[model samples]
Target: MCIQTELQRFQTEFNQTLVQTFSQLPNDIAPKLHQAMEYSVSNGGKRLRPFLLQIMAKVLAIDPKLIQPAAVALECIHSYSLVHDDLPAMDDDDLRRGKPTCHIQFDEAHAILAGDALQTLAFELLINADVQTDIKLSWVKILAQASGYQGMCGGQSLDLEAENKSVGLESLANIHSLKTGALLKAAVSMGCAAQRNLSDEQKQKFERFAELIGLAFQIQDDILDVTATTDALGKPQGSDQKSNKSTYPSLLGLTGAVHKAEQVFQSALEQIEDLPYNTQPLMDFAQFIIKRQH
Candidate 1:
């Protein structure tokens, strides 16, 4: 199948599976909190992280059913991070996916609880998956490190600290490596973990690919913040500039930032070239990240 067709099919399958999985959440939970959680998860973005996990599983010939739990779990964790990130104490944004942020649609306290619930729910889904003990344990550790203080959260802290300051390129890269790249790396690693046959070296190569793509993804985001319209992006355009946060375009000029993005994009393709499987989808995904409007 063509890359576009494959992505469309994967997105449909992902949405159906995600809705079904969330439907299994017990009805006994508080109605308002439940509604907030459902609203946040169901209201969508690109679902890129989970899509990467599913695609990697497909490439490895792992059972799609086994991949579902991790795919959903990663998305849950991703959504939870966004929810907290948009809270008044964080990014303080009022919009996401062209809709009111969780804290805006619901109250701040409920949004906080919803994010907390989703965070814990991710672990529950992973633990309950029909996988071996050691692999499951490994996945749990990977996720914790990626989404916790060492990864996304830590990156956000660094980002907050860097605000209104002229940060060097290396300092900015370090911040994004943890903030944006950590979970993305975990997505690829989790997919590899599901397959018991991959060697350590193979896993490392895939991770390197993911890391470069993650950086590329962030660079494109910064470019779009300058170049794309709000309607196209679904979020406010130029919010990064509005927030005075350091971005690629802020440090490197527009042309230079685009060049940097292309460089990282090429490096990602090279990283995965030696893998045994056809990598058209992964390459296409890297292209999509660079070209995406939002």
Candidate 2:
């Protein structure tokens, strides 16, 4: 199937599964908190992390059901990060997914609680998944490392520290590698783990692919911040530039940033071509990262 067609089909199926799973969360004691959690997650973005996992599952010929929990867990973590990222202390974004951010829609305290709950819910889903205990344990460790100080959170800290400061391209890459690339890399790892068996060489190849794609994804986001409209982005466009934060465009210039993204895209395609399985979905995803309007 064509890339867009396959992606659209997967997006619809994943959305249905996600909504159904959220509906199953209990709401007996803290209805308001539950509502806030739902509100935060219901403002869906591209669902890219989970889609990466599901695409890997498809490539490996694993049953999609086997990876559903992991996919949901990954998305939960991603959404929680967004919730916290949009907080007044963070990016201070007032809008997300074309609606008010969680902190604005509800309250700051509730938004914080919702982010916390969603993070924990991610681990809960992983631990309770039907996979073998050892596999689940491995995945939990991978995800924890990805989301903790060494991964996304650490990256955020670096980003906060680097704000309004002159940072080199290496520093910017490091910041994005942790803050954005870690979870995406983990998504691919979790997908690989869900597969029956994969060689060390194969896993390394996938890791390389994820790393390249993660950087490319962030670069594309930086590009979009400059190129896309607020309505198209669902959040304030040019916020990064407004905040004076270091981005690819800020450091490399818009044309240079576009060139860098293209380089990464080409590298990703090379990685995909080396894989044993059909890699059309992965190639399409890589292209989507650079080519998407928002």
Candidate 3:
């Protein structure tokens, strides 16, 4: 099947799972809080992090059922991050996925609580997963580290600190690697961890692939911020420039950033070349990451 067709199939199945899971939430919860959580999670986007996790599970020959909870948990964390990231104290954005942002649609306090609830709900889903204890523990650790101070949160702090201040390429890369790359890498890592007999070497290779693509993904995002229209991005174009935050395009010129993205993308492809499993899907995903308009 074509890559686009395959992605659509995965996305459709994933969406059903998400809806089903959300529907199971207890009616006792505060109605507005529940609605806000549902709205944020249901807001449309590519669902790339969960897609990466699911695709890696396929490559590793892990059962989709065994990994489904993890996929959902990853997405919850991603969505929660977006909710918090768009707050008045943060990016102060008014739109997401072409719709009013959580804070805009709801009040700031509710959006904050909704983000908190979604974050806790992520771990709750993982704890209730039917997978074995070790795998569950591993997933928890991977996700917490990726989302916590050592990873995404730390990256966000660095990014905020760098605003209106000139930062070098290395500093900018470090910021993005933690801010954007950590969770993406964790998605791949969690999928690999699902394989009972995965070797250290195999795990390392998959991780390297994730790291390269994560960097490329950020570079492509930076490129698109300058090139794509607001309609295409479904968010403000030039927001990065407006915020005066350092980015790949800011450090490297636009031409240089594009070149860098391609270079990293090719490196990611090479990482999967010698793996025992068929890596065509992963390669296609890497292509999509670098080539995507938004």
Candidate 4:
């Protein structure tokens, strides 16, 4: 199938499935809190992480019924990060996916609480997923390590500290690897974990691939911030610039940033060469990352 067709199908089915997942939650879990949960999770975005996980599951030719829990758990973790990332203490943005940010719409405290709840919910879903104990334990450990102080949170802290300050490529790579790359890596890891088909070396290769794509994805976002429109992006263009954050475009010129992104993209693509022919969706997604305007 064409990349567009694949992506559109993924988006439609993922969103629908996510909404159903949200609806299944109990109302007694705090109505306002639940509303905040719905608001954050159901907001418009690419839903890239879950989409990638689901596609990876498909690449393994696994049944959807067997994969929904993993996919949904991935989305929950992703959504939780965004909720925290948009808080007053973090990105502090007023807009998200072209709508009011979680904090803006629901107040900062609720947003923080919502984020905390979502983080916990991710683990809960993973542990309760209709999968084997070993698989659940492995996935939970991987995700926790990725989202903890050593991963996304650590990256975010570094980013906050590094703003407006110059840093070398090694330091910058560390930041991106943690901030953005970690989750993307987790997405791919969860997919492999879902299948338990990847060997240790293959697992390492997937990690390397995800790291490259994750950085490229962020670089593409940096490019889009300068080149795309708010309508096209569904969020404020130049928001990063406005926030005075360091980016590839800021460090290396736009041309240089594109070069950097391309390098990562190519290296990531190369990792799939040795694996079996289960990489079409992954390649398409990588292509989508480089070419996407938003």
Candidate 5:
């Protein structure tokens, strides 16, 4: 099958599974707070992390059902980051997925609280999920590390510091590797961790694959910030430039950014080319990151 077709199939199932699980959260926990959590969590994302987890599962010929906790964990962490990132203290974005941001749609305080709750609930899902204790512990540890100091938060701290400074390509890559790539890397590793019996070498192979694609994903996001329109993006475009944020395109130029993304994509694909299966979904996903207008 073609890449888009595979992606579409996964996206459809992932969305359905995520929504169904999200809806199962208790309604008694302050309905408004639930609303905020639901609003942010249910807000549209490409569902990239969980999708990556499923793809990794496919490599093992494992049932995708086994990875629900990991998938939900990915979505929760992703949504929590967005909630905090859009706050006045952060990006101050007004729109997301074609709607007002969490702070705008809900109050700023609720947004903050919701983000906090989501972060905590991510661990809760991992612990309380109906999985083997060994697997749950491993997944929990990976998510905690990825969403904490070594991952998204760490990256954001660097991004905040680089605001007025001229960040070089290496620094930019480092920041993105942590800020964005960490969770993506975690998603892949967590999927492998969930496997009943994956070889250490197989796990490493997937982890390496994750690292490559994860970095490529962020580069594509940076390129889209400059190349895509707000309508297509479903959020304000050019905000990166407006904020004077250092980006690949700004530092390397647009043509150079595209070339850099291509290089990263190829590097990612190279890690797994010796495996005994087609890599069309991964290839398409890499291309989708750069080729997408939004």
Candidate 6:
């Protein structure tokens, strides 16, 4: 099947599972909070992290069904991060996935609570999944570290701190590696953890692949912030510059940033070349990442 066709199918199935998961929430929960959570999670965006997890699971010869819960859990974490990132206290954005941000559609307090709820719900889903104890433990540990201070939050802190300050390439790279790259790395690692036959070296290769793509992904995002329209990006164009945040394009010239993205993408492809599986899908996805307009 074509990669686009496969992606569409995966997206449809994943969205159904996500809606069903939301529908199962206890009736006693606050109606507004539930709505906000659903609104944020269900809003349309490329399900990149979950899709990467699913693809990695396939590469590892694990059943997609067996890894579905983990995929969903990873997405919840990603979505929660976005929700909080768009809050007034953070990026202070008003749009997400072409719709009002959670805080804008609801209110600041509700958005905060919704983000908090989604964060905890991610762990709950993982713990409740019908997987082995060790697998669950591994997923929890990987996700917690990625979502907490050691990873995304830490990166976000660095990002906020770098605003309006002149930062070099190394400092910028370090900030993104923690903030954006951590959860992406966790996705691939979790998929590897699900497979019992893989060696530690093989797992490391997959992680390296993820790290390279994560860098490429952020670079592309920086590029799009400068070049794409607000409609195309589904958020304010040039928000990074407006916020005075240093970006790949800011440090590296636009042409240099584009070159860097392609360079990183090529490095990512090398990581998967020796893996014993049909890697066409992964390669195609990585290509799409650097080439994506949004």
Q: What are the per-model C-alpha RMSD values against the true structure?
A: 1.1, 1.2, 0.9, 1.4, 1.7, 1.0
Instruction: Provide the global lDDT of candidate 6 against the true structure.
Output: 0.90
Alpha-carbon lDDT, every model: 0.89, 0.89, 0.92, 0.83, 0.84, 0.90
Give the candidate number with the greatest TM-score.
3
**Where's the lowest-lDDT run of ten residues in candidate 2?**
1-10
> Per-residue lDDT for 159-219 in model 5, tens only?
9899968999899999998998899889888877877576787677767877777777778
- For candidate 2, what's the RMSD? 1.2
User: Which 10-residue span in candidate 4 carries the lowest summed lDDT?
Assistant: 59-68
Q: Write the per-residue lDDT of candidate 3 for residues 179-242, one digit (tens) a residue.
A: 9999999999999889978789989999999989999999999999999999999999999999
Give the alpha carbon lDDT tens digit for every residue of 5-37 in model 2.
777787788888878877888777799999998
The per-residue C-alpha lDDT of model 6 at residue 131 equals 91
Reference-based TM-score of each model? 0.97, 0.97, 0.98, 0.95, 0.94, 0.98
Model 1 poorest ten-residue lDDT run: 1-10
Report the lDDT tens digits of candidate 6 across residue range 1-294. Answer: 866788788899999999999989964669999998988898886788899999887777888888888999989988999999999989999999789999999999989999999999999999998999999999999999998999999999999999999899989888888998999999999998898888888889889999999999999999999999999988889999898988999988899999999999999999989987777778888987788887
- The CA lDDT at 85 in model 3 is 96
Model 6 misses residue 199 by how many Å?
Answer: 0.6
| Count of backbone collisions in candidate 6 | 0
Question: Best-fitting candidate, measured by lDDT?
Answer: 3
Q: Which residue runs of candidate 1 sit more than 4 Å off their true CA positions? A: none
Return the candidate ranking by lDDT, descending.
Answer: 3, 6, 2, 1, 5, 4
